[model samples]
Target: MLAKSIDRLPPPRAGGWRYEPKFDGYRALATIQTDSSVQVHSRRGTPLDDAFPELVGALYAYLPAGTVVDGEIVCWAGGRLDFNRLQRRYAQRRHARELAVTQPVHLVVFDVLETAQDGDLRRRPLRERRAVLERLFRRIPARSPLTLAMQTSDPAVAEEWFDTMAVAGVEGLVIKPANSPYVCGARVWLKYKSRQTTDAVVGGVTGSLHRPAALLLGRYGSDTGRLHYAGRTTHLSDAQAAAVAPLLVAAIGGHPWPVRLTVN
Candidate 1:
């Protein structure tokens, strides 16, 4: 089935709901059919089979057959989420293998879409789906590789987490509708970053850094019809070098987004 995403968590109605703390990482869907084989997908609808190899091992070990889940793939660094480390794994094979041995990997599963052939619950309310998810996760031993995402019904608690996580160098908060179903490709998942940032068009890039290369990300200006290099990230670990770098390069057309920004 085609999976969609929601922009924000919906408000509670007459019925109650379950709210989960959104993890700061890649939004992925994990599928485990009857044979216990697994597949992980990215939000943009790309297969993440090559990106996270270790997770494949974990999924094979923990997930059961005929079950599919929606969740985040996160790497904890210094007690909080680290995008740099997360990006590093995608950089090179050597780094990925090295980090796998050092840091390891974990999954924070939040939703269950299909439990069995009959349990295609994408259309169910978020609250009800979460009920099934919670019970199922509870049955799985905590010492196992998978972990349930932290959640709270209280807005205050959610806010508190947002505050603490921000101070801890985390990315942002993801608020989901407690009663909402898995709306693939939609905006049901609301992502609140520390700063309101957009994926701008990158006109040019800088030279290589510790690993392979650095990048210049930018956007098109409405009135000027020009591309401007807005930001640079030297901390783009190894993973970004291999995956995101090529994509950013390919996105360049004759003039880039605005057709004005140049390499200086």
Candidate 2:
């Protein structure tokens, strides 16, 4: 399932929502076949087995056959989540074993899709699926590479985690409805990312107005009447692009930086 971005965490209410910290790493699905063979891949269908052999090895050892799971592949370094190391692990697949001893990767699972006891849980409520995932983890060794993602229904606890986890590269909270079933590609869940309010003008954009890739921000010197290039944003998600596309307007003639900003 996917999530739509929101500004803030809503106050607790009846049929309260739950929260999971958003890890800054590769989102992947891990599946163990009936024969105990394992496969892990990203949502885009890119196979990750070669990139993270040790993680796959751990999954094969800990997870039972007929089980499928979804989670992020993260690595830690110097007491914080190290995304660069995570990327290197993906790139140097052949050296995975050597690096696995130095910089081991981890799979922080959040949802259980299929279990040995229950064939499929995608159609089940998230609460039920979570319970199943927790039970499955009970048999895993404490030092196992497979770690369950933290979750809580309490807003206060969520807020506290949102504050503390940011230091560990957790970007934000993924708010989920307890009763919602897993619906692939659906934006039923809401995500609240950590951001500071800043004021800047949309001086330009990378993509077309109807399908903007990212905003090129700028600020004008009041007396000089000059547009100073501020900064480009991270690539916009589909939801963000959709929301901003309609609000964008093409720049007219005499455009600043008209030569096309490119690194030589």
Best by lDDT: 2
**What lDDT tens digits, residue by residue, belong to model 1 across residues 148-180?**
877777767766776677755655566666667
- Candidate 2 lDDT over residue span 1-264, tens digit each: 998999888766666798999888899999999999899999999999988888889898888899999999999988888999899888998887888888899999999999889988999999999999999999998798889999999889899988888887788999999988998899988999987567898977878788889888888878888897888888999899999988887677777766587521
TM-score of each: 0.65, 0.78
The C-alpha stretches of model 2 lying farther than 4 A from their native spots are: 11-14, 196-231, 235-264
Scored by CA lDDT, what does every candidate get?
Answer: 0.68, 0.89
Best by TM-score: 2
Model 2, position 65, has a per-residue lDDT of 93
